[model samples]
Target: MSAHQTSSPAAEAGDPPPVPEATRPVRARRLPPLRRGLLVPAALPIAVGLWIASLPRVNVDAMGDLGLLQVLPVTYFAALGLLAVGFLAVLREPRVRQPWAAGYVLALITVIHATPSALYPALRYAWAWKHVAVVDAMLRHDGAVPHSGTLDIYNQWPGFFQLNAAVLRVTGLHSVLGFASWYPLLANLLLVGPLLLLYRSVTTDRRLVWGGVWLYFSVSWVGQDYFSPQAFAHLLYVTVLALVLRRLADRRRAAAAGTPSARRPGAFVLVVVLIAAIVCSHQLTPLMLITTLLLLAIPRRNRRVVLPVLGVAVGLTFLWDSTVARPYVSTHLSDLIGALATPDRNATSGLAGLGSAAPGQVFASWVDRSLTATVFLLALVAVVRHRWVRRTGLPLMLLAPLVMLPSNNYGGEMIFRVYLFALPAAAFLVATLLVPPWPHRRWRAYASGLVAAVLLGGLLFGYYAKENMNRFTAEEAAATRFVTSVAPPGSRIVSVTSSLPGGELGYDTHERLVLAQDPLDQRRLLLTDPLAVLQSTMDDPRITGPTYVILTRAQEAESRLTGVFPVGTVGSVRAALDTSTLFQRLYDGPDAAVYRYIGPGARPSPPGSVQP
Candidate 1:
């Protein structure tokens, strides 16, 4: 042997020739299965235990403008920390463990999303209760809600309500309210599968895949996951995107192998079905889907597969808008066109001024803004640093929804919807910055865990900070029920805002008016002379039947937090009603009150007297 070829002890002993260090493959050190399995299992119970113990300590009634964050115990935050550390530790294992990572993600979802449902006695969001009312309308009218007034939009896009109506009938349940509070938890859980499919299709790195999933849930503080059509349609939208991307991946692999790509007729059919469902369920998601597909089709390699799906989506959306949704579309056509001309307004419409919001709410809003900016900043860094992200069209997907920002504000919620649709791609891109494809030092795990903690901290604030307004009390629900039951069809119901629970219970039969949503001049009049505004609304020629005004804690909270009315508007209005004989108190409670307006010429009644 040449002197340059140094012989090792193994070679001297007649063992196989020693492999050269430079040419040898390196294997990452993996955690033992026993250790990996025990970490998450132990952490899960501790986190869950901490959460359960903290629940009883929550004071829902005492929640201030900061919402759940103001009332949630320190133990709740401690639980989140433990879960974050456990997830990071398990994720850093050289060979990522699927079950452990998924378990931590699911546990986080439970602690964050399920806490509100558990703490609040009644359903949380007023919009969710309104959606339940839509389902009730469907059940009452035998699957058709005619003359739904402004709520006719729900009638036009009735797929979500129809599905719930069927579920209620099949299960023999009386109302969606039974399971509505849990919908956030359920909707988030349903997202896990498609998220996995999407991340895996784009990359083979397990760390990136699971990290993206964790980050998706951590920063998804947009409160759109309530029991609404948009939430359901969003699930369908993510599923369709996942399947299409998987197909793209398959075709890419087949081309590299120089093999004929097999046709996936079944998958194509499934994608079409999901797209149709999305088109029918919500008006906005379909447009989002089409924009995303058109962007995905920009690459020549992806065009063949993507253009067909895009065609179907566009056709279905056009057909739906031109037919069943025509009334709403035609009515709002000019406004939509006008919105397209003012992209700046469309983009900034959802960003209300913080000066009028409560101090705590202002802080919460800033936290949400910081969190969203951080996610996008990190994703943008990933795009600049990682070529594969752009190559895979992830950036395109992340930015495609921006196109809608210049089209229509979607009633001032277009910004949030854009964030919602863009989150999946943004999450994965951000994960690429934190979770390396190959094993590294222990400090990376700690650093990633620290980032996770900050993201979750922001998430808690963004999601629960408005619970003071979002949550409805049992008394509020009862008051709304009483008003709905006693008022005859064609009666008018007025409220400080639409935040009252069950406010839309009989929306089809009642003409509803929100003082906060009134014309600018009228809303200003409310701040000055609320009683006069109420009296005028009652005496309007259009309101031929009974007129009732509802004042509730949730409405007051919403008015204060959103600056829809001055700080003490609801209270001042209530006091005015109490002093005036023209208004008769029908139902009064600590959390809510209902008052009926007597005719202007009726004789004045004694104070504190209830009309028979």
Candidate 2:
């Protein structure tokens, strides 16, 4: 029969003819419910158990140049591997389960971030300790810390501290130290919600959405998720952007439906409140938020939703900077101007040379660079190959922060900040590449798992490579506390480096003199005749009170890691003080020592009569 005569009745009724068997679409295979249920449920607990089993084996003292990576047991990596494999397996299923994917992401965050809290006796990172001190000062001064000296920046943008103070008051917790150790884990968990919101706004595919979230945590090696104002402000910043992006998506839908956009005053108010919170809490994040919002608004279709948020961010930032943060801005205005004047320098300032870093640290730094480049490369490929990513404006969002790189060096951290702000978009783009819109082959799952493992390795190396400098010993804490407790107000507290935990405990009461910041000649003097440098600093007429010199293991690690001083500068200086009769040994411990500079004419204390 002729082809037309052989046509089906359905075709005659204007329905399409039956597809040939060769061209028929095949249903993707899915894992059986029973198998999936058992496997996915068991994966998380096993991974958690492995991680827990691995922590005790980590000897923080014996950690080498690679930091925690050197000390972490093989089981820890096994845990990470198991999670990566399980996550990829789940994603490979024809029907991705949200709960299983989210569970794996949460597990990844916990495994990565909770390690420090579990292993370290005290909080990690000196800056976190300093922030705790800021909270203490705020509580003492009733929401305002006066005479904050170098740390006055915290007081200028006191919103974060004030919030912590209020929390302390409400919870009756003496200090943030009580929970600061776990802040990294909690902050990362808090980020997941907004990330889901942001990713969902752009795409409905669960695999892409959850894969991006997993990738985000996997490569977020910046270590900015610690207990700091930046961490808190970043959470709020992400939330604001997610809400704004959702609004943008809504506007597009409304226009498509031929309906004028509806104004949701509540949502707008919420965005303003979050923007205000972000501006008041952190300095850099507000600028980033404003830049991103302005870029989103550049598309005429998005201006109606994005412009208002951008305006609010700008106005709040201006009001806070001109009013509350005026002191810091005015004082640093020239430096900021100088940074802006030299755009090339601003762009390259954050890139530190590896000449001075330890051999292992140099390797870790290269790993970090490689990981960053890999992510950018994947995103670039996605942009070139996938029209959906470009159509959705994700590339624009990802590249928006590049404009800020030449604006200010941000104390040589602008490059890092740009990467951080660009990370969300980059993660989504990378996810599109790994988990494409169309299904292809089993090799895709293997490729995803392989890439994830590489990124995770990079994350581990990059994030933990400098833990020797970031981690503080109990002795270091105790010695710092002892000095702060005994040293009189206005006394000069000196350290070879600022890596001592609790170094800023009495920031308002004591004067700080970090020898690391000393002039080149003075640092050289410190290397040769530490006595003269200590004596001169102690005898400075402006320092009318006693002077305490603190040397810590972390300080030595920092010196060696950054080449701020000679590799054994701390040890040599400690040795000099130990043998010298001019300086009194106030307190001595294995990991740290405290020395007081008495006048040259004064006799030393009797042997074994050192103060505690």
Candidate 3:
């Protein structure tokens, strides 16, 4: 028979001929998943490096914009676009012991999120100053300070500050400032891998797990992840939740096998201790975390973890508040009770209070709401449409943080934070829309992956765009440094609001805050009706000592955008200061100004104050 002819009897009987061995297409063994997706992820580092290198070390631009989005080099967007490419490419990888593509995608997500911290010349946010001051105090005093009735919360939650002090002490960096500026980037980078561990516990689908993690980072517009106790505690919180989920899965398997409970009691104790640590470290995170844990355990009938953890949290909260935070706790107890008592009112206030403030703020509020609602809507659709019963704890976890919403206003951001806590689960559910564990057609899979990317990128853009005006500036930081260094201790420094002058510094001793919001404190100045507040503070005899009034570019932006001060009010105040002889211009930087009131009968400070 010819080479192309049938060689067997079966082929000869009206059967197709078998092709010669040499003619057959060589079977191409597919490349391993890691190497298949390796090009993009590997190039991702190069692209990020180039992007960061090309980016001019940014301080806030003249307009007081962190200028993150506006001044970002083209490479910045190119890097983000490349990351999205790598993410989509990874989705095509087959499920195996490890989805290597997911790892690549995770790395990219972190690099993108950490960019602001990496690009900035100095630490930007105002709260970070307070945190730095607290750590400075800890390093100076050798330990936590006792209560200062109405000052910073460091007196109450000193663990994070103490930890920062320890880091400074160990690194001999002099101040956490060096670390603080880059802390957000570092915190975000650290958060990525561990978050995957938590997601893995909640879902077996590798795609869903990766997508959920990606989604969480993409929509992180709340900016609560700044270098603060909340950020630190949140990292711990994710770790604790992941551990509990892992253990619960293991214990269930053991139970099914009729094996004796192995170290279940020990695990319970460990979780309780972790909860205690969280309680000590953050004011609100522990409560949110506990609510989540209890919700998880209650539905699963797993009492061991929640029972002891909740008990420990309660006792620690009470003991700590009753002793260390006594003045604060006693003063706010009734108010806390009142807020918690009318949760419906508080919930509305928390979620809707900031929406009407400014055009930019309104846009931000809508973007945030839309991002959350989109993910949640996706999750709900997945829940209703998917026929297979996913036996994950995510459903119940979604309801848990809602229970914490009644706790307090948390300065009108309580709901924002609650959504943040629920994001992992919501992201998981959103991923479920595309994450079918079983294999499917390539086109369908790729289409879903593209959809996921679009959803994520849109949310991320929303997250970044909304903060166009709020990024703190370098000049404000300089003014803060100068004031903190030059101002005589026990001197009163009044500010319109905390958004500028980085009011967080010298909060306790070197300076006293007379904010309009704090009527109880005589020194607390007002942001609104600048002239009236000024005249009142200056004319009042109690303010005999010299007082400095500050106005910074960032504060002006904040006041304008958030409507904290009326439009052009910052300039109006400054103009008033410039015209009035009563207030002497002590030191004026391009972006920040310091004025000392030399009213009649006020003793003059030594001439020539220090300048930054």
Candidate 4:
């Protein structure tokens, strides 16, 4: 179409001859839509495979279904679609400003930060029920999974369980380990995306931004990195941070110009959604959100938006819990609150020595391998000196974590996920201090040392934390295997209360054995179901037949049982005991003993037979 003559720029005089038309201003060739879709499936397998491969395999069966092809396709496609949607949704915003070079570095830091718990199976016998019970309920078409009458609901955070079940429906993965581990990995990785966006919003220095990110995952003063629902809450907290900052900025600019700020409905909407997601994920998250929002409000002094935002947040939280969580919580409040207040049968005072002075214990623990304490101290110092404390609402943000210290000992406080809020704030405050227009050389060194200390502290703590749990893994594995081997196929074995001291903690794990149908036929494990046991006794007057009972010798419950023979003893399952070898598995630790039900004429008791 071009008989066009080119411009005669001083023609070929000052510059070389004009470049050929073919090479001039060439456009990138776009891939066809079909080609684009195909690339996702084709490229995905390789990436998913690589991601899966990178995961360390210790008792990988505990990881569940990584190799199971049945659900892999569903997970891959779902993750792909989600990522695509997120990308499209953010398209109108400015492109993410962080350098691509940091991807590997940030990922490495994430791995290091997550390293401690990363090695364990996603479905540990402890708390495994929280997830697997939901799976069981979905499979049963029961309204929800069934638990003893005394317990208000079958599990905690039933909503989160339902979400996990939805994944199972799409993927057709029934393995407790597979579903638990895989979703967490996916959720955790997705968590990084918002954090990156947050980093870009807060600062531009690549190193400082990443350091903040590093601290986000590294610091476990709160357990967000453990890949529980709290991890999801942490991401939401970041969004809240970004939103708060933007609102503050808008307010400040408006005030300076003597005009009203752009109080967009969209900003308010986003804050509402972020908060809903957090609450939907876990009940404890709202405390952090409310606290942070209040802190952020200090700078803006703008109630025009803040008031509405708070109202909306409160409304959504009420909606989430009221719909399902609150009803159950209300029903079970006495039980839960009671459990929290009373020291459990095997309970150690969670706060025994962890007073203000415990920082030394923390420091000593981290001296060899981790830098968490150093990182935190530096962040604390940086926060104070850099004026982040007084300048932004962050000073108040620090209080969220502080509030958790007292709660740890006040009954059920140690278990409350509310403690997680401190992690993001701590991390953010630290990064804010370190990255910057260093006012002085001494500040730079101090900031650098602070980061180093934190890094060192995290590494140390993570190492010991893992080591401390080594024997725990061995014992748990052995005990689980023994239970699986001895129990009859499809037999709903009621685990003695002693078998799971502090049932609240081990509930998740108990639920998983029921899911995996472990070799011992641990298809349905019942703990503290005295009514069920009493019913079984009534059904079989002969006290003869194939019925079996699992009991813990000399436990309070066993003593209460009046008359039940202890059939056999298996391995100890305590988390605190340390020594172990290949030949023998310890069945008891500093905590409790495990016993199997083996009396003759045993039968599962009918429901409603025994009263507490």
Q: Candidate 2: misplaced stretches above 4 Å?
A: 1-24, 27-38, 603-610
Point out the worst 10-residue segment of candidate 1 by lDDT.
14-23
lDDT digits (tens) for residues 283-322 of candidate 2: 9999888888888877787777788888899999999999
Q: Could you give candidate 4's per-residue lDDT for residues 270-342 as a string of tens digits?
A: 7777777777677666656765666555544545545666666677777766776776768756865565455
**Ranking, TM-score, top scorer first:** 2, 1, 3, 4
Tens digits of lDDT, candidate 3, 144-261: 6543335456767788888888888888888887777777667766777667777765444556667667667766666777778888888777777777766665555555555765
The candidate, 1 or 3, that scores higher on TM-score is: 1
> How much lDDT does each candidate structure score?
0.84, 0.83, 0.64, 0.43
Model 1, residue pairs in steric clash:
none
Q: Candidate 2: which pairs clash?
A: none
| Structural RMSD, model 1 | 6.9
| True lDDT of residue 65, candidate 3 | 24
- Alpha-carbon error at 88 in model 4, in Å? 33
Q: How far off is residue 522 in model 2, in Å?
A: 1.5
RMSD after CA superposition, every candidate? 6.9, 5.9, 9.3, 15.5
